[model samples]
Target chain A: MGSMARAKVVALSMVDKHPEPQPLLAVKLSPAENPTAEAGADAAAPINSSALPAPEPEVVPTVSLTKVFRNLLAQITRERITTAALACVSIGALFLFWYIGTKYRVEFYIRFKNVPTPYEVFQQLTQVGLSNKYLVNIAISVRRILLGFFIAMAIGVPLGLAIGKYQRVRDLFMPVVEILRPIPAIAWVPMSIMLWPNNEASIVFITFIGAFFPILLNTIHGVHSLDGVLIRAAKCLGASEFRLFLNVILPGSLPHIFTGLAVGMGVAWVSLIAAEMISGQFGVGYFTWEAYSLVDYPAIVLGMITIGFLGLACSGIIRMVGSLLMPWLAFAPGGKR
Target chain B: MIMATAMAETQKGLIDVRDMGVTFGANDNKIIAVDNVSLNVQPGEFVSLIGPSGCGKSTLLSIVAGFVKPTSGDAKLDGNAITKPGSDRGVVFQQYSLFPWLSVRKNVEFGLKMAGLEQSKRNTTARALLDLAELLSFENHYPDQLSGGMKQRIGIVRALATSPQVLLMDEPFGALDTQTRVVMQEILTNIWQQFKISVLFITHDIEESIFLSDRIYVMTARPGRIKAEIKVPLPRPRRAEMTDTPEFMNLVQELKGLIREESLAAMAPEIKDRGLSGFGMKVGPKGVGDIF
Candidate 1:
């Protein structure tokens, strides 16, 4: 019975993907003819019913294509289908607008004459994606970003903790931080180049500068926002100063620390791309700038798309890690006290 | 038997406060939280501080817990000054101050771990305390997953994990619903009876004070001073039914009257500013409903 259900599922999935009118009939009728087949298929059906196509039909029957499509639609949740449909529509609308604007060469206040159409960019993406050079550039940019972000976390989090926990340390370091915080990362490029040994060091330093302040400021805020009663509770429970920090202060500040990390990652990408465009030998940012210089407009758009996806992937990774580290947050909304 | 004798010789859980006062800020900004408050708790006694809001009941408790330094006098435990918080005294806050990142068992074991207890011993102590609270099944759950009553119960169990001499609780059951609060009071009394540890509890609930404390100290409004000290003559191993007796009702009435007077006094300045000097008299005959 299990193997029979499995074979039926394979046939149904093939009908879904290929949409053969004959196979659709077979799927729609097999469930009706043998009542137990429907129950078995429902139980054995995989979450993603769009896998590889099966050649042979398990149970042939006679039914219309529309009826089979309706049956398949009924099996999934209505809300999920609606949400997915809405997302696709919105994305499609954006592409349609971009395609028309670029194809017609709209010359509004911001000219679209030089911009590539969706097709042109897709064509460029397929061509560029095949090359080892493009992958190397992406890898280099990712490596630089990870190195700078990790360094910022290592130094900024501890310094922020110290500055937040101790009044004397705050007083000593706050003046310097306040003075340097407002200066943009781009402005530091010249000074960073002079300070560091090479162009790579300078670019990394600029990325580090971008990521550091947000992490530091948020950490300080996290520490400041800790409940005083919690500290007192820990102290009364025999926690020494160091133990109190480990048990109460550090764990208490983690949610805010993650907030800082996410914000810092976004800023790190912006800073890295800016630094790369200005001084990098090889990276996605440099590729975009180089394409612009060589008048390869489609590749420039492809570079931007790559950066957007990479940034999204990095932020998503951070979010996933944060939620994993703080499982208590998942249960927070259920009970407040 | 030898260990029992040694424990008796250590002078377990005696809290002494002598004319202690705490003042916050300096000069014109200064606010006196507690003033000239003198109180003491005998070993194994259950004492409560009851007062109007803004009164120094919690401030006084904080002094004994060594979280605040008194501006005038001193607070002591076992004849030595309590200059700082120590393992000998455990505190439970109204906020249910369990670390959200930790599981229930880990929170209960926190103090033991801090005192450098071995992992196996910590687990044993935590499991025992959790079992005592009837929360052994929820040992793996985080604090945020629990209800108000459960959290406070965990808070109490966690505080008692280290076997502290004195337990300081600041309105631990105040956030719970009335039904849960009653159940919590019974649980606390049971725990107190079994441990025979001294307790210094702070609350604004008159009935709760009457029900829980062997002795109750009532304080006046802000710049708080001890207005009255009353003792409960109820027998030990107290049951929930004891709250219905004539004696409990009488004590509740007396404490209510005392607190009502202080509450009115606390509202005096606001009443005067509103040009309602005789408001209390006007509301007195109407049974409080008419004014609202």
Candidate 2:
């Protein structure tokens, strides 16, 4: 009896996980009246009937389960299949355009004569994808991006929080931020090289510069955009200043902070590649620039594709981490911002 | 009963406001939000402030919650002058101010956790409060997953979880549907009865104020000042049926009359300046009435 009750409890709890529509399990198990008794009987009967291989009642829940599965499959396919197909079509069209342009050696304002054909780029991809040197270059560039991005986040978030929360901090820092924010990452290449001790440090510095302002600005906007009522609610609930910041301000600003991080990841990749191209011996950016100097146009195209893929992956990881960090955002209408 | 008695050891939750006024901006931009609004709530009483839109009822509630400092006059909670927001007062806002990041249970436990309660105790307290709100089953649900009514109920439960001496509510049910608002009123009254905490509720709803409050204070238009204070003679454990009674209806009418006057007064300047007075004038040839 205890085991039957336990199974019943488990079944009921599982019902909660079902999406908005009522689970078929409930209807299959019992009539509208005396739900508990009928549900309990059905719950215990399922186990007993399974052991005895009884076909009559067992068929009901099995059919219901299949229906539920079919419903879920339909829902997933309905929303995702169209989107996926459109994305495929879009990418295919882009590739087709590229193939035509390079194959015909089309020249308008920009010349496609020197550009690698799609097949040549694919050949380069196969060669590069197999090479140890290509892997090393990718690894070097990724390390630079991660290091620079993390450092930017470490400084930008706290500073942005302080600036957003306090007038004095905002006044003290905003002028400096505004003045420095306009300087482009490529323009910082010369200054960064002179400022840092080594080529690696210089490249990372340029990446950090590329990533920092967006993060700082977004974090500030997040703090400013926080609903004032939540802060008041926190204070009223006995939160001290530090507790308020940790519990309210920090979490409140997180969505924007994640937005910053995602944007920063992309910018970091851009700056890292640019800096590497300008002053590095062993990175994807350097690989691309070297390919250009060597007139290996296909390798250059391959490098560009690799950089694009890595940047997308980095930003994708950031977004996944953000969604994980803020599980409630999933429940937000129209999906996560 | 013993727990209630122990919790009531101190003479807490007494809210006293004296000639409170709040003015914003400076020079040409100066706008007075509230003016000479004085009222008091006994330790366990449910009092409401009802006024026209922009009548500064929310501002008055904010002053008591210690979110806004009044330009003049004194506000105190249990004899301690209100300086800044503290744990002694719990506040519920109209906008369903549940932290979007936290689940229902976590939102309730926030205050207990802030007071440095251990995990087990906080969970127990939060669960107990969620049970009171009939939301224990939804403890794991986020705010957005809930309806507007459920979210506001969770907001109330979260405020109550702290076991504050006083609850300050600013139009907490304003956003709910009429049916949901009535249901919420019943729930709120039940919660208030169980907790026996002082309440200063701000609303523009006449029936709501009369239904839930022991006393209702009506305020005038902008630069809100206390227009009148009326005591509700309705019996305790207020039910929806009471809203149909003569006494309740009379009180509602009186409050309505008082507020309607203020509302018109509030709208007078806007109507004149914005040329909205034409709304009351005879219809032109293009009027919807002519088409009909």
Candidate 3:
């Protein structure tokens, strides 16, 4: 029959051994019949009849969309639902404000003439006609972001672990990291161009700079918070310092480091866009800048949306990875993983 | 494999501590957590350190484990100065000390894996240990999923897995429920008989000390020092029903009396320092979660 009916069938079979009265099921299963009180009470008598185990309902464990959807909905906790609703409301408000503010002149008391209407943007999106150009741009941008993010991780993770665990290493590098952290990624473009032989390398360098500090600092914080007792436990169990860091310190600090990576990925996107806007070709950021130069407001908005989507996806993937690595955390209360 | 190897290494009086003392923190904040806590454990002996909270019993155990260095005098393991934590000494803390990331089997296999054992051998050894301890079914389970008693029992198995020269337990059973604690004690006594490793078990429970220990070292409260060294004269293959025996009850009473006096002695200095709280056994409105 229908998916909902199938789901009910499955639910009923699971508790069929102690099946509750199925008045609702009866009404759904046989709509032609007008049920009387005598019939309903007579139907309830069979529930106890099944307790003696003459024959049970056919066990159908068939997978259905309704079952999957219901289970997923059930797993979406109150806190998660609240959070999702808040985010939807916030983004929806932004969209509504954008659409209404640019509806026409004198909209919302005052409005910028340069801002495009929501439908105008959506209309331009369908008529772009150059899907390959968009794909090529997005692909190159993603590649650059990935390259820079990985490079940042390669340097940042080991450095962070070392600096976190050893006071001497921290003292040696903390001043340098602190000094470098505050300087914006855009400011590095000029230096990067001078330091590198190619525009792509310089752009990637800027992105790397943007992603590096967040990853390093968060990893360090994670390592710093490593429970001293776990270390002792590891030590007493015959682990050398190197082995201790690998077995305990690295894994112990993973949750914090994953947080860093998520934040770093977002920063990587931001810095890559900035870098591309300044001096590069073939990226969503460059496309936005080109649209600006050509006064394509819709295209610029499209670029913004693409970048936001990519950043969100990257962070979402990081969170998924974190949950996979730390399965225990997923089942814990208030565990976002 | 477990019994024969353990018996071969059962040399009496393996751990020696002479006037072992430990003070914590820097100049102004420094507190003598342990003072002249002298005790020793014969090889295969189940020695228990019993005292009230804040009595530095854990500190004494740490000194032997080589996690904490003694401030004065010395503690030796098999005649060597216990300077640094090594594979030879396995330690089990109270609850929540198991590595949450590792599976129960992996936690037990941790030391063996660290010692560079082959993966197959480590698994075999770990599984064998789990089987003996009645925890084989829980090999894949996480520590967070297990009950307090199960966790501590597995914690004991993890410590014992490496077959250390000595097993230093710091209030390992203090977190279990009363019933689970008794079951765990029986399991531990049985395992100790089989493993035949020297144990320096720390506990705040008086009857637990009397039941599980060959010798119970009762320490005074904070700035803890050994106040009494009572030898348990009870016979081996101890049963839970033995607690009802007159001898067991008498030993329990004797330890309780000794611990109470030490608690008073521990409270005496604090009473004078506070000045207004001059007390004859006044219970404080506080909880101790730190080293005791």
- Report every candidate's CA lDDT: 0.87, 0.86, 0.81
Candidate 2 off by > 4 Å: A1-78, A104-110, B1-11, B27-29, B269-292
Global lDDT for candidate 1? 0.87
Name the better of 1 and 2 by TM-score: 2
For model 3, the TM-score of its B chain against the native B chain is 0.87
Q: Mind giving the per-residue lDDT tens digits that candidate 1 earns over A1-337? A: 6655566666556556654455434544354334354465644443333442342353453334555677788768987789999999998999988988998899879799899999999999899887999999999999889989999999999898889999999999999999999998888888998999998888889999999999999999999998887888888888998998778888899989999999999999999999999888899999999999999999999999999999999999999999899888887765323
What is the RMSD, in Å, between candidate 3 and the native fold over all Cα?
A: 10.0
Write one digit per residue (lDDT tens) for candidate 3, span B1-292.
3553475465633888998778999899999998876777877888998888898987788888787888899998877888999878888888567888899999999999988999999999999999988989999988777788887878788887778878888888877789888999999999999988888999888888888988988888788878888999999989999999999989988888787676666655676465445654553544465424
DockQ of 2: 0.66
First chain TM-score for all predictions = 0.76, 0.78, 0.76
DockQ for every model comes to 0.63, 0.66, 0.48
lDDT score for residue A307 of model 2:
91
> Candidate 1, residue B221: CA error in Å?
2.8
Q: Which scores higher on lDDT, 1 or 3?
A: 1
Model 3 ranges with Cα > 4 A deviation: A1-97, A104-106, A109-112, B1-13, B24-31, B268-292
In candidate 3, the residue pairs with backbone N, CA or C atoms under 3 Å apart (3 or more residues apart, or in different chains) clash, namely B13-B42, B56-B292
Q: Put down candidate 2 lDDT per residue, A1-337, tens digits, no spaces.
A: 4545566565555554653324344443332122344554654564444343323453346446755776888778666889989999999999999999998889998899899999999888887788999999999998888889999999999999999999999999999999999998989999887988999999989999999999999999999999998988898998998998899999999999999999888888888888898888799999999999999999998999999899889988998999889999888888754
Clashing pairs in 2: none
